[model samples]
Target: MSELLHLGALVPAAVGVGTLLAMRRDAGRADVLAAVLMLVGMTDAMTLSFVPPVVWFAALIAAGLALAAGRRFSPVATARPGTMVSTHLALGVISTAALILLMPAMPSSTPALVAPSHEHGAGSTMPQLVGAGLALSTVALAVVALRAERSWVHRLHHTTMAASTVAMCAIVAI
Candidate 1:
């Protein structure tokens, strides 16, 4: 079931990538890059357990920082009316990294009614809360993108990214 959910999450992200690439002449390089990064992050979430969690976390953090730096330093980013897309992508990457870092600390399963020993202790609650918060924030960003973006393609891409983020969170945090 979990695997199915993870794969389901990838669909929207793949759509977003396809949407961006299909309109490559209209989309900015930054936009395409952001969509690809989002796709990569979602893919990583699905296959995260294959390697050490720290490695994934570190890579995500570095990617996030690079995105941030690019947004901050790039003349094109500064010239744009709003840097919302770049900011959103950077936050998504960092949030994914944070969630991945917290995954090992989270309970593998929900506590059973008859098995109190299965209950997650207080230590696990923080990660859960953080994951929920990130998920909510991504949803909020999606709403904002729908309202703020002028282009239909951008709106679709942002919405898909948000859905992917929420799905990834559900897979890792739940």
Candidate 2:
């Protein structure tokens, strides 16, 4: 279970980095900031299940600072007049905030979930199912953003940050 959650965290981090690289040519300050914020949140998720809470605590703080700084320093964010800018910031902050709230609530030592084993019931499996659902949702959102008439970067940023939100939910349930 922990391993799966950890893997889940890695997947999005990789995706964020790839998106960051893919967007670098056209990325403004806000886009880069948003990408970095997503990376930080994803990093925190990876640490939550294995490392001490202090690591994630630091990540949470860093994410908060980045969000604030991004909003203040990015000309595109401030100069633009659209929901996209605010939406990215909101998703990043909300995702990190939820992780901050949920970390301590997780059991410190949960037994590993065995595949094809009967030790745990359907109740225990719910988290995995939910995680899968969220993962699928992320894919669907990405596809929608790809096909949307709006600027692909803006739409994709919205979709990518949203992955962080769902990823946190999936991680917590795990």
| TM of each candidate vs. truth | 0.74, 0.50
Candidate 2's TM-score reads 0.50
Candidate 1's C-alpha runs over 4 A off are 22-38, 75-80, 104-123
lDDT of 1 at 43: 64
Task: Compose the digit string of candidate 2's lDDT tens values, residues 1-174.
Answer: 655655655565556545545654434555455556546545543553443444555655566566556655664423334334433443455445445445333433333421121335755665455445544655565555455425655565556555655656666664
Best by lDDT: 1
Task: Give the poorly placed runs of model 2, Cα more than 4 Å off.
Answer: 24-34, 37-41, 44-51, 69-74, 77-86, 104-149
In candidate 1, position 59 carries an lDDT of 77
* Residue 45 alpha-carbon offset, candidate 1, angstroms: 4.1
For candidate 2, give the lDDT of residue 19: 57
